[model samples]
Target chain A: MKDKKPMKSVFKAGAITSEFIGNSIYKHQTKTSIGAHNIFLGQVRADDIKGKTVSAIEYTAYEDMANQKFHEVRESAFEKFDLTCMHIYHSLGTVKAGEICLFVFVSSPRRKVVFEALEFIVEAIKADVPVFGKEIFEDESHQWKLNS
Target chain B: MLITIKYFGQIAEVTQKEEEQLEVSKGSVSGLLNTLNTKYSDLKNKDFQIAQNQELVDLDTELTGAEIALLPPFAGG
Candidate 1:
């Protein structure tokens, strides 16, 4: 008999799912774009605090609010930035301190706008999104980062 | 009724638990916070914050019959 994994998806899965969708949508929209595509992937760094290595980072979010905020960010980016496509994804579960947790992808008809748009969207996500991360040290101590 | 309040990050460390829904009369956000702080003295010194309905909120916000969420000054990338 084959063992079945948990059938119900949790909020953690929702964030990853949306992120995948966002990337897929961007690819579909920009299939005909004829310029540079810049992507920035934010990996969790192992910050050395008092000689302890950052073992992992735990992310938690008000999922409902996060989804709403993400949608709004997408809409505003589309309206304000002259870009062929863009995508943003963030992890909602435990991400190893050195693993990638956030990804920002942008493709545009011109390289200049794509560069600018990447900066804008990343800053907006850091400032406006309701996601939170707790850094767990090797010794099990933790500290929260204020998206700075 | 006890409304379990969940604490995270620094808040959780101070509170020593992930959640604690204390008994309070359905009241404003400030009112609920006041009672909570009065009970949890450790929360008094922490630079914590509040969230209602999954969004950060100010102190004066009303919460008569809404899902209240409390958060500390956000820490995310």
Candidate 2:
């Protein structure tokens, strides 16, 4: 059976706060059927480039396409794994170093499914989404970040 | 035909604008790229992919008067 369409917005302005993350986890407590939950958080790193350190990442995206791609990833994951639920949130605008930029949470009745599904969703997001990031240096200069 | 082209991220920076409309004769995606390359010389040096109507298309793909977007390298997590 096809999964229901994902109606939630995956993009959030600025950073994904720990409070928000905590609340999300708290909300999932009522789903007693879900025995395992796996979470992946992507944090911005302060990488030194030519003696300049990255202070923040300014993100931008073709919003319509990104959302569509996110939905496709979710659907594919559900079809491949027996997941109970999954959530993905990505930050737009400026996210400071050490702040969360991406969060992927997956739940399943079994631990193995959650583990495999989380990695699949994360990898798909990195490779397929049209979101872009500009690395702002401490010197005020900036460079585009390429997925490696 | 009048085609609307959207630019994102560093590609937008190089173009110095978010989007533009151009009147062009019937042509392929490569033909559109040639026109844009002439209009914005800086874009020639950048690496990017082209999306037509929100889906990635080959340069040889014919222009169907769809919304075109120039997307830079994805760094999304």
Candidate 3:
């Protein structure tokens, strides 16, 4: 039987605050079944290209397709691992350097499961999602970012 | 048929608009791309993928008059 997981909105405007991430972890305390939780946070890097330095990243996506892809990744993670729950959040607008742009959280009953599942989910997200980033230089010029 | 085409990120930057409606002849994805290429000269130099009905499709796939999108390289983490 196919896993029928409900779709959740993963896009957030601007940068994801540290307080929000802390709150998310605090809330999961009530889930007593979850013994291990692995979190991955993607920060905007201030890359220096030539003489210009990157100040921020402006993110955009094909929302309908991106949400669908996120759903598929979640389902596949569940199928491959004994995951208790998973949550993914990505920024939509401008995220300044050193700020969090993406957050992926996975919970499981065992430490080993969380480790493997976290890497799988993060890799899948980078490879599969249709999210785009425009790296803005300090001089106000921008260039498109590609996954390496 | 009239097809709604969506553009995102750098692809939208090249098109100078987010979405537009175009009248296309019965053709394959490559044919539609040719029409778009002729209409927007800047599009030819840009790198992107075509999605039909929200799914990534190859150049040889036939157009089904669905919602189409021009997507640039993904940078999401």
Candidate 4:
């Protein structure tokens, strides 16, 4: 977190479902000015580590701090890109492999802007957010995940 | 000063609790960490960052008795 002023945004519980993502896109249909939309979905990978295969990831965060960081990322994205709208959601609790855990949606008047804005926002979230993940193996053993 | 400290991810695992309050002398963040290392011996070996209030602070920064957090390497996507 970069700022002491905490911004409040509730964390989403469980995996992000396709239905939820669909509904989000459905709602955006009313914003006709947005000519292009780009999305980034972060899915849990069943990675193998030391002979153990990951079955799920349990995410946790310093919620108040994470909210504050998210606020900064959002504010900076708006300032740097001409985005018509932006949305981000990250999962708390256990998300199994193949399930979506992070969703970033960005829209703009032009295709190029949406593409660039989406990449910028996604990279910022990875580097700045305080969210942590515990990669749970099939046998119940787990290890903390690190951003590469 | 009474300081509140929070632990997350692997740091919480080492500390064995998520949050705690301690009565400590006002000092640099590293000084407070020295006290914590004595209490939680594994904390010194863990990879983490210190946050004073909610902002990330280095070890040399003075503690302000605000809410502090020990954060491990981030995995947020």
Question: Candidate 1: where is the Cα deviation over 4 Å?
Answer: A1-30, B1-6, B14-27
Worst 10 residues of 3 chain A by lDDT: A1-10
Model 4: how far residue A41 lies from native, Å? 0.2
Per-residue alpha-carbon lDDT of model 4 for B1-77, expressed as tens digits?
Answer: 99899999999889889999999898899899899999999987899988998999998899887988999999997
lDDT of 1 at A142: 81
B1-77, model 2: which lDDT tens digit per residue?
99999999999998999999999789899999999999999999999999999999999999999999999989997
lDDT of 3 by residue, A39-117 (tens): 9999999999998999999999999999999999999999999998888999999999999999999998789999999
Q: Which candidate do you rate higher for TM-score, 1 or 2?
A: 2
The digit string of per-residue lDDT tens for model 4 on A20-97 reads 999999998888888898999999999989899999999999898898899889888888888888888999999999
Candidate 2 per-residue lDDT over residues A46-80, each given as its tens digit: 99988999999999999988998999999999899
B4-55: candidate 3 lDDT, tens digit per residue: 9999998898889999999999989999999999888999999999999999
TM-score of 4: 0.96
lDDT agreement of model 3 with the native: 0.93
Q: Give the clashing residue pairs of candidate 2, or none.
A: none
Please compute and give the TM-score of the first chain of candidate 3 against the native first chain. Answer: 0.96
How far residue B15's Cα lies from its native spot in candidate 4, in Å, is 1.1
- Cα lDDT, all candidates: 0.69, 0.93, 0.93, 0.90
Grade the docking of candidate 4.
high
User: On a 0 to 1 TM-score scale, where does candidate 3 land against the true structure?
Assistant: 0.97
